[model samples]
Target: MSSNAELHTLKQRTDNYAYVLRCRETGLCAVIDASEPDSVLELLARIDGRLSLILNTHHHPDHTAANPELVARTGAPVLAAPWSGHAGSGPDITLKDGDPIILGRLRGTVLATPGHTLSDLCFWFEADRLLFTGDTLFSMGCGRLFEGTARQMWASLTRLRALPADTLVLCGHDYTLGNIAFARSLDPHNAALLEWEATVRARKAVGALPPHPTLGLEARANPFLRADDPDIQKSLDMPGADPSDVFAEIRRRKDHFTA
Candidate 1:
């Protein structure tokens, strides 16, 4: 993306993450998944940001709880998936797959990735190689099948796996450490997974957030994203099984995972 476009990642309500995207040239800003109204408003005030848009990835409260306050405060329009259950006056602009979203000079495309929720939408800024994947995709894990099927989630992940290898994945939550544990359980010998776990632990030890992994790194390390890998399939004793099936089994195990 342009050097003029800046992104601020805000930690919210425990593990949730919200983001502020600002366009320097226009001084226009957009908040993605404003989970905490107070925090987001405080940041906007500090930065003197003129909020022009509020973007939501899903209807979950953790992602939309601040919609009403934000919309009322800034008069900014809310852009979200058609099925979004906003706490405010619904979405001002309902987006679908392939839709275009413009923030000043930056352009983004909406990807309908329904798995975590039937309404999950991911924003991809091709120029900047920044992908804001709400709850659909996580660091080393994928979201649970709350309102969609395993097949849907697997297909959604497959589409994301095709993005530019360098794309920076900004997910909704920071589950890196826990996810690393799960990945190791399945792919214990994966050098990439082991290395990533070490890096994440080191960051945590120093009180730093885990570094956002590039799409390429995710493809290599995230077991959920590698459901199609022959090695993973073999490890699961499901060699040659459909990738979606493998993905479903993994998700099931994750849902019941302890530690």
Candidate 2:
């Protein structure tokens, strides 16, 4: 596998994101999360026009709404967890944790991360050192605990945090602004976070988002990832509390956050 695999990000709706992974040498391509089939098809044409696989991070309609349509148009095999109801008539290939999906010379390893949904999965391209975190882990926060419990979510995040520090994370939505707002309410004195908020706000003001933050940067700026941090724990008045318990409180406050 030549390390020339390139990623292209597509925004569907207001906050949703769809990504395309393409091999620069072979022109082989894989589409991740088909939010809108039309938009994906258009981008496919622009990027070599060869769709070999459709990878869904979760069964949410926002992510898989275009799955069936895309399969119908391109005849590409869809790969997703069996529990994801939005995989249309089910995936052509049922993906499991630690399994790899190959496209040309590129390979994406599947990781089961059930939090927002029981079937949530993230795709990790180890060769490229990139991770496509569906909704479980975002830029500065994580997904809401819709179907999974707070403890489950905590474990899920812990697993992600253990990945290589330099790994680049591509998440499901554009919630950095709202996440930063909530983070500031707790870890106010974090210089890295304050600087990140200023930079993200400026980008938003100009209608552009800052380049996706890496795992190392998120570890510093994202409060959810820092649920056990001294300042965050102190702010919540839970000094020496369990990380999971601390995470639950942070999640509770984030749910009621205005911005």
Candidate 3:
């Protein structure tokens, strides 16, 4: 309630992050994704097993693989999108768009973001200005449209873009380096993109993943978020095209991008 929440970003084998959120006042905890049972168990042990909830951003195997094991171990109920295609036990709490999630004194709202999957959801803690974005919205790029349409993905991203500029984005994967390379290709002359690329390279050189960036930084440096920019549109050879059309072209190119 006071925005004094502790979030532990646990990196899994797939470069995916499983966020462990705890309320300082109540000692209540919840996890964002359960990629690995061992990792989740270890984290819960470190926190003295205070876990009370398990929420999945989507139903991808890599994201929801450990749900059943974790639920058996901690008895924490699973919360996921209503249309979730969970392979494990079904969700105990089916979350719809804009549903409220309560964890002790902390409260978060669920945002339906269909793109990578029709059931993708982003969890937003407004008081703390924190967002746990799944595959839908990444740092410098958005997720591939595996189930939904490019138009749907673009709309979903636009929704995220409307959030507070200072919101801290905790994306599901550590794909920043690759995404930055793609962003630089389109906006070669963007000073902000260049600066951010240097910082990202420095972090990787030391065997570290890029730090989570704020919404403000992403809005300026991320090509996917800046699909409406004249530079990106020109790069795609689609000047004056609908922003969603431009976004679709970018996503198509990214699908085959090696970098």
Q: Give the alpha-carbon lDDT of every model.
A: 0.90, 0.85, 0.86
Model 2 weakest lDDT span, ten residues long = 83-92
Candidate 2 lDDT tens digits, 1-259: 1368888888888889898888886777888886888888888888765888999888888888888888889899988898644345777888999998787778778999988988889998878878899899998899999899888888888888888888888999988878888888887778988888888888878977566778888888788888778878999999999999999999999999996
Off by over 4 Å in 1: 84-88
- Residue pairs clashing in model 1 are 1-128
lDDT of 2 at 85: 45
The most accurate candidate by TM-score is 1
Evaluated at residue 197, the lDDT of candidate 2 is 80
**Residue 47 in model 3: lDDT:** 76
lDDT of 2 at 31: 87
RMSD of each: 1.4, 1.8, 1.7
What lDDT would candidate 3 get against the real structure? Answer: 0.86
- Per-residue accuracy of model 1 over 1-259 as CA lDDT, tens digit each: 5697788889999999999998888878999997788888898888878899999998888888898889889999999987633444568899999999899988999999999988899999998889999988899998999899999999999999999999999999998889988988988888888888888889899988888888998999898998899998988999999999999999999999888
Best candidate according to lDDT:
1
Kindly list the per-residue Cα lDDT of model 3 for residues 183-209, writing each as its tens digit: 877887788778887888898899887
- TM-score per candidate: 0.96, 0.94, 0.95
